[model samples]
Target: MSEALLEGGTRCLRNVLGRFATGVVAVAAADPADGTRAGLVANSFCSVSLEPALVSFCVAHTSGSWPLMRGAGLLAISILGAQQRAAADRLAASGTDKFHGLPWISSPGGAPVLEGSLAWLECTVEAEHPAGDHTIVVARVRALDAIADGEPLLFYRGTFGGFSR
Candidate 1:
Protein backbone atom coordinates (compact mmCIF):
# COMPACT_ATOMS: atom_id res chain seq x y z
CA MET A 1 0.00 0.00 0.00
CA SER A 2 1.03 3.57 -0.55
CA GLU A 3 2.24 5.78 2.35
CA ALA A 4 -0.85 7.97 2.06
CA LEU A 5 -3.11 4.95 2.36
CA LEU A 6 -1.28 3.74 5.49
CA GLU A 7 -1.53 7.16 7.10
CA GLY A 8 -5.20 7.42 6.28
CA GLY A 9 -5.81 3.95 7.64
CA THR A 10 -4.16 4.83 10.95
CA ARG A 11 -6.28 7.96 11.35
CA CYS A 12 -9.41 6.01 10.44
CA LEU A 13 -8.66 3.53 13.21
CA ARG A 14 -8.30 6.33 15.76
CA ASN A 15 -11.50 8.02 14.60
CA VAL A 16 -13.43 4.82 15.00
CA LEU A 17 -12.01 4.18 18.45
CA GLY A 18 -12.89 7.72 19.55
CA ARG A 19 -16.55 6.73 19.48
CA PHE A 20 -15.97 4.75 22.67
CA ALA A 21 -16.40 6.74 25.89
CA THR A 22 -13.64 6.71 28.49
CA GLY A 23 -13.01 8.13 31.95
CA VAL A 24 -10.08 10.50 32.40
CA VAL A 25 -7.40 10.02 35.05
CA ALA A 26 -4.19 11.66 36.12
CA VAL A 27 -1.19 9.34 36.56
CA ALA A 28 1.66 10.67 38.63
CA ALA A 29 4.85 9.87 40.51
CA ALA A 30 7.19 11.76 42.80
CA ASP A 31 10.87 12.01 42.02
CA PRO A 32 12.94 10.34 44.70
CA ALA A 33 15.83 12.75 44.31
CA ASP A 34 14.01 16.10 44.09
CA GLY A 35 10.64 15.07 45.58
CA THR A 36 8.92 16.67 42.57
CA ARG A 37 5.73 15.12 41.34
CA ALA A 38 5.18 14.70 37.60
CA GLY A 39 1.84 13.77 36.14
CA LEU A 40 -0.43 13.79 33.09
CA VAL A 41 -4.13 13.43 32.42
CA ALA A 42 -5.09 10.48 30.24
CA ASN A 43 -8.26 8.76 29.15
CA SER A 44 -6.41 5.59 28.33
CA PHE A 45 -6.64 4.09 31.81
CA CYS A 46 -8.16 0.59 32.04
CA SER A 47 -8.18 -2.48 34.22
CA VAL A 48 -6.13 -5.33 32.85
CA SER A 49 -6.68 -8.05 35.43
CA LEU A 50 -8.35 -8.96 38.70
CA GLU A 51 -6.44 -11.83 40.26
CA PRO A 52 -3.26 -9.87 40.60
CA ALA A 53 -4.88 -6.47 40.40
CA LEU A 54 -3.29 -5.23 37.25
CA VAL A 55 -4.09 -1.98 35.43
CA SER A 56 -2.81 -0.29 32.35
CA PHE A 57 -2.64 3.12 30.69
CA CYS A 58 -1.13 4.62 27.60
CA VAL A 59 1.26 7.53 27.28
CA ALA A 60 2.51 9.21 24.17
CA HIS A 61 6.13 8.57 23.27
CA THR A 62 6.86 12.26 23.46
CA SER A 63 5.38 12.69 26.92
CA GLY A 64 8.04 14.05 29.25
CA SER A 65 6.15 13.27 32.43
CA TRP A 66 5.81 9.58 31.68
CA PRO A 67 9.55 9.12 31.65
CA LEU A 68 9.95 10.63 35.08
CA MET A 69 7.10 8.56 36.43
CA ARG A 70 8.57 5.41 34.88
CA GLY A 71 11.77 5.91 36.79
CA ALA A 72 9.91 5.94 40.10
CA GLY A 73 9.09 2.64 41.78
CA LEU A 74 5.43 3.52 42.27
CA LEU A 75 2.77 5.72 40.72
CA ALA A 76 -0.65 7.06 41.59
CA ILE A 77 -3.45 6.74 39.09
CA SER A 78 -6.14 9.24 40.12
CA ILE A 79 -9.44 8.78 38.39
CA LEU A 80 -10.56 12.36 37.93
CA GLY A 81 -13.97 13.51 39.04
CA ALA A 82 -16.10 16.04 37.20
CA GLN A 83 -15.06 18.89 39.49
CA GLN A 84 -11.34 18.37 38.98
CA ARG A 85 -11.02 19.97 35.58
CA ALA A 86 -8.35 22.31 36.88
CA ALA A 87 -6.37 19.40 38.22
CA ALA A 88 -6.55 17.70 34.87
CA ASP A 89 -5.36 20.80 33.06
CA ARG A 90 -2.64 21.43 35.60
CA LEU A 91 -1.24 17.95 35.23
CA ALA A 92 -1.45 18.12 31.46
CA ALA A 93 0.38 21.44 31.20
CA SER A 94 4.11 21.93 30.68
CA GLY A 95 6.71 23.26 33.15
CA THR A 96 6.74 22.93 36.94
CA ASP A 97 4.20 23.16 39.76
CA LYS A 98 1.80 20.57 38.44
CA PHE A 99 0.53 19.93 41.94
CA HIS A 100 0.38 23.62 42.87
CA GLY A 101 -3.03 23.93 44.50
CA LEU A 102 -4.17 20.32 44.33
CA PRO A 103 -4.76 18.54 47.62
CA TRP A 104 -2.93 15.25 47.91
CA ILE A 105 -1.14 13.00 50.36
CA SER A 106 1.70 10.55 50.15
CA SER A 107 0.95 7.01 49.19
CA PRO A 108 2.65 3.96 50.72
CA GLY A 109 5.38 4.15 48.08
CA GLY A 110 5.77 7.90 48.49
CA ALA A 111 3.81 8.81 45.38
CA PRO A 112 1.43 11.75 45.43
CA VAL A 113 -2.04 10.60 46.36
CA LEU A 114 -4.53 13.08 44.99
CA GLU A 115 -7.74 13.74 46.89
CA GLY A 116 -11.27 14.21 45.46
CA SER A 117 -10.74 11.66 42.74
CA LEU A 118 -13.25 8.91 42.14
CA ALA A 119 -10.54 6.37 42.91
CA TRP A 120 -6.80 5.91 43.11
CA LEU A 121 -4.55 2.97 42.34
CA GLU A 122 -1.02 2.90 43.65
CA CYS A 123 0.96 0.66 41.32
CA THR A 124 4.35 -0.41 40.15
CA VAL A 125 4.97 -0.60 36.43
CA GLU A 126 5.38 -4.24 35.47
CA ALA A 127 5.71 -4.10 31.72
CA GLU A 128 5.80 -1.72 28.77
CA HIS A 129 5.19 -2.14 25.09
CA PRO A 130 5.31 0.16 22.11
CA ALA A 131 1.93 0.47 20.48
CA GLY A 132 1.65 2.72 17.45
CA ASP A 133 1.96 6.33 18.66
CA HIS A 134 1.90 5.50 22.37
CA THR A 135 3.50 3.21 24.91
CA ILE A 136 1.25 0.86 26.83
CA VAL A 137 2.23 0.70 30.49
CA VAL A 138 1.00 -2.25 32.49
CA ALA A 139 1.23 -1.95 36.22
CA ARG A 140 0.49 -4.17 39.19
CA VAL A 141 -1.68 -2.46 41.78
CA ARG A 142 0.02 -2.60 45.14
CA ALA A 143 -2.72 -0.57 46.80
CA LEU A 144 -6.00 1.11 45.91
CA ASP A 145 -8.50 3.58 47.37
CA ALA A 146 -12.07 4.06 46.27
CA ILE A 147 -13.71 7.36 47.19
CA ALA A 148 -17.42 6.75 47.12
CA ASP A 149 -19.11 9.80 45.41
CA GLY A 150 -18.98 12.32 42.60
CA GLU A 151 -19.51 11.96 38.86
CA PRO A 152 -16.54 10.91 36.76
CA LEU A 153 -15.06 13.18 34.13
CA LEU A 154 -15.59 11.62 30.74
CA PHE A 155 -13.72 12.08 27.52
CA TYR A 156 -15.55 11.64 24.24
CA ARG A 157 -15.12 13.11 20.79
CA GLY A 158 -12.14 15.15 21.92
CA THR A 159 -14.06 16.96 24.68
CA PHE A 160 -14.49 16.61 28.45
CA GLY A 161 -17.94 15.98 29.90
CA GLY A 162 -19.83 13.97 32.51
CA PHE A 163 -21.87 10.81 32.35
CA SER A 164 -25.49 10.21 33.22
CA ARG A 165 -27.27 7.23 34.73
Candidate 2:
Protein backbone atom coordinates (compact mmCIF):
# COMPACT_ATOMS: atom_id res chain seq x y z
CA MET A 1 0.00 0.00 0.00
CA SER A 2 1.29 3.44 -0.93
CA GLU A 3 0.01 6.80 0.35
CA ALA A 4 0.07 9.64 -2.10
CA LEU A 5 -0.96 13.16 -1.16
CA LEU A 6 -3.32 14.68 -3.68
CA GLU A 7 -4.94 18.06 -3.80
CA GLY A 8 -8.71 17.79 -4.12
CA GLY A 9 -9.42 21.45 -3.32
CA THR A 10 -12.57 22.77 -1.69
CA ARG A 11 -14.97 20.71 -3.75
CA CYS A 12 -13.15 17.54 -2.82
CA LEU A 13 -13.16 18.43 0.86
CA ARG A 14 -16.90 19.17 0.72
CA ASN A 15 -17.64 15.99 -1.20
CA VAL A 16 -15.59 13.92 1.21
CA LEU A 17 -17.30 15.43 4.21
CA GLY A 18 -20.70 14.89 2.61
CA ARG A 19 -20.10 11.18 2.80
CA PHE A 20 -21.21 11.35 6.42
CA ALA A 21 -24.98 11.78 6.55
CA THR A 22 -26.43 14.23 9.03
CA GLY A 23 -29.84 15.23 10.23
CA VAL A 24 -31.36 18.48 9.03
CA VAL A 25 -32.51 21.14 11.46
CA ALA A 26 -33.63 24.72 11.26
CA VAL A 27 -31.91 27.18 13.53
CA ALA A 28 -34.13 30.21 13.97
CA ALA A 29 -34.19 33.25 16.12
CA ALA A 30 -36.18 36.44 16.53
CA ASP A 31 -34.92 39.93 17.23
CA PRO A 32 -36.03 40.67 20.74
CA ALA A 33 -35.98 44.38 20.02
CA ASP A 34 -38.12 44.42 16.86
CA GLY A 35 -39.77 41.00 16.69
CA THR A 36 -38.17 40.20 13.34
CA ARG A 37 -37.52 36.51 12.79
CA ALA A 38 -34.65 34.85 10.95
CA GLY A 39 -34.27 31.20 10.08
CA LEU A 40 -31.83 29.01 8.17
CA VAL A 41 -31.69 25.32 7.53
CA ALA A 42 -28.48 23.58 8.63
CA ASN A 43 -27.13 20.07 8.41
CA SER A 44 -24.20 20.76 10.72
CA PHE A 45 -26.27 20.91 13.88
CA CYS A 46 -25.02 18.45 16.47
CA SER A 47 -24.84 17.77 20.17
CA VAL A 48 -21.50 18.96 21.40
CA SER A 49 -21.57 18.32 25.13
CA LEU A 50 -23.98 16.62 27.48
CA GLU A 51 -22.73 18.00 30.78
CA PRO A 52 -23.85 21.52 30.03
CA ALA A 53 -26.46 20.41 27.51
CA LEU A 54 -24.76 22.20 24.69
CA VAL A 55 -25.14 22.04 20.94
CA SER A 56 -23.13 23.33 17.98
CA PHE A 57 -24.04 24.44 14.47
CA CYS A 58 -21.91 25.93 11.75
CA VAL A 59 -22.92 28.98 9.72
CA ALA A 60 -21.02 29.95 6.62
CA HIS A 61 -19.19 33.24 6.54
CA THR A 62 -21.35 34.25 3.60
CA SER A 63 -24.63 33.74 5.43
CA GLY A 64 -26.48 37.04 5.45
CA SER A 65 -28.99 35.91 8.04
CA TRP A 66 -26.43 34.61 10.53
CA PRO A 67 -25.72 38.12 11.70
CA LEU A 68 -29.36 38.71 12.58
CA MET A 69 -29.12 35.85 15.06
CA ARG A 70 -26.42 37.60 17.04
CA GLY A 71 -28.92 39.86 18.75
CA ALA A 72 -31.09 36.93 19.71
CA GLY A 73 -30.80 36.17 23.41
CA LEU A 74 -32.45 32.92 22.51
CA LEU A 75 -32.31 30.70 19.43
CA ALA A 76 -34.70 27.92 18.54
CA ILE A 77 -33.82 24.75 16.67
CA SER A 78 -36.41 22.63 14.90
CA ILE A 79 -35.54 19.08 13.90
CA LEU A 80 -37.37 18.62 10.64
CA GLY A 81 -39.49 15.56 9.97
CA ALA A 82 -39.16 13.34 6.94
CA GLN A 83 -42.14 14.95 5.22
CA GLN A 84 -41.03 18.56 5.68
CA ARG A 85 -38.78 19.02 2.64
CA ALA A 86 -40.66 22.15 1.61
CA ALA A 87 -40.09 23.73 5.00
CA ALA A 88 -36.41 22.80 4.84
CA ASP A 89 -36.05 24.23 1.35
CA ARG A 90 -37.84 27.41 2.29
CA LEU A 91 -35.54 27.98 5.20
CA ALA A 92 -32.47 27.14 3.14
CA ALA A 93 -33.22 29.70 0.43
CA SER A 94 -32.07 33.27 0.68
CA GLY A 95 -33.90 36.64 0.56
CA THR A 96 -37.40 35.20 0.66
CA ASP A 97 -40.26 34.99 3.12
CA LYS A 98 -39.00 31.91 4.91
CA PHE A 99 -41.85 31.92 7.35
CA HIS A 100 -44.58 32.56 4.86
CA GLY A 101 -47.31 29.90 4.97
CA LEU A 102 -45.41 27.98 7.61
CA PRO A 103 -47.07 27.11 10.89
CA TRP A 104 -45.03 28.21 13.86
CA ILE A 105 -45.18 29.81 17.23
CA SER A 106 -42.93 32.06 19.24
CA SER A 107 -41.24 30.57 22.24
CA PRO A 108 -41.52 32.36 25.54
CA GLY A 109 -37.89 33.27 25.11
CA GLY A 110 -38.73 34.96 21.79
CA ALA A 111 -37.39 32.35 19.37
CA PRO A 112 -39.66 31.30 16.52
CA VAL A 113 -40.55 27.64 17.02
CA LEU A 114 -41.81 25.90 13.95
CA GLU A 115 -44.74 23.52 14.15
CA GLY A 116 -44.56 19.82 13.16
CA SER A 117 -40.91 19.49 14.17
CA LEU A 118 -39.75 16.15 15.44
CA ALA A 119 -37.97 17.93 18.30
CA TRP A 120 -37.32 21.46 19.47
CA LEU A 121 -34.52 23.09 21.39
CA GLU A 122 -34.62 26.66 22.62
CA CYS A 123 -31.13 27.83 23.42
CA THR A 124 -28.94 30.81 24.09
CA VAL A 125 -25.56 31.54 22.62
CA GLU A 126 -22.88 30.29 24.93
CA ALA A 127 -19.76 30.88 22.90
CA GLU A 128 -18.59 31.41 19.33
CA HIS A 129 -15.39 30.60 17.53
CA PRO A 130 -14.12 31.48 14.10
CA ALA A 131 -13.52 28.39 12.08
CA GLY A 132 -11.83 28.53 8.66
CA ASP A 133 -14.57 29.80 6.36
CA HIS A 134 -17.43 29.20 8.79
CA THR A 135 -18.39 30.22 12.28
CA ILE A 136 -18.86 27.62 14.95
CA VAL A 137 -21.74 28.60 17.18
CA VAL A 138 -22.06 26.81 20.48
CA ALA A 139 -25.37 27.24 22.25
CA ARG A 140 -26.65 26.15 25.62
CA VAL A 141 -30.06 24.54 25.78
CA ARG A 142 -32.57 26.33 27.93
CA ALA A 143 -35.73 24.52 26.94
CA LEU A 144 -36.11 21.28 25.04
CA ASP A 145 -39.07 19.28 23.83
CA ALA A 146 -40.08 16.69 21.30
CA ILE A 147 -43.44 17.65 19.85
CA ALA A 148 -43.71 14.76 17.48
CA ASP A 149 -42.45 11.23 16.91
CA GLY A 150 -41.27 10.16 13.49
CA GLU A 151 -38.24 9.69 11.29
CA PRO A 152 -36.16 12.77 10.59
CA LEU A 153 -35.01 14.11 7.23
CA LEU A 154 -31.49 12.92 6.48
CA PHE A 155 -29.06 14.68 4.19
CA TYR A 156 -26.40 12.58 2.49
CA ARG A 157 -24.06 13.37 -0.37
CA GLY A 158 -25.77 16.76 -0.74
CA THR A 159 -29.22 15.24 -1.16
CA PHE A 160 -32.15 14.32 1.04
CA GLY A 161 -33.33 10.76 1.63
CA GLY A 162 -34.84 8.63 4.36
CA PHE A 163 -35.41 5.02 5.28
CA SER A 164 -38.71 4.73 3.46
CA ARG A 165 -37.63 6.80 0.51
RMSD of 1: 2.4
For candidate 2, write residues 94-138 as lDDT tens digits: 999788888887776779888888989999999999999999999
Write one digit per residue (lDDT tens) for candidate 1, span 72-93. Answer: 7789998889998888878888
Q: How much does each candidate deviate from the true structure in C-alpha RMSD?
A: 2.4, 2.3
Backbone clashes for every candidate come to 0, 0
**TM-score of every candidate:** 0.89, 0.92
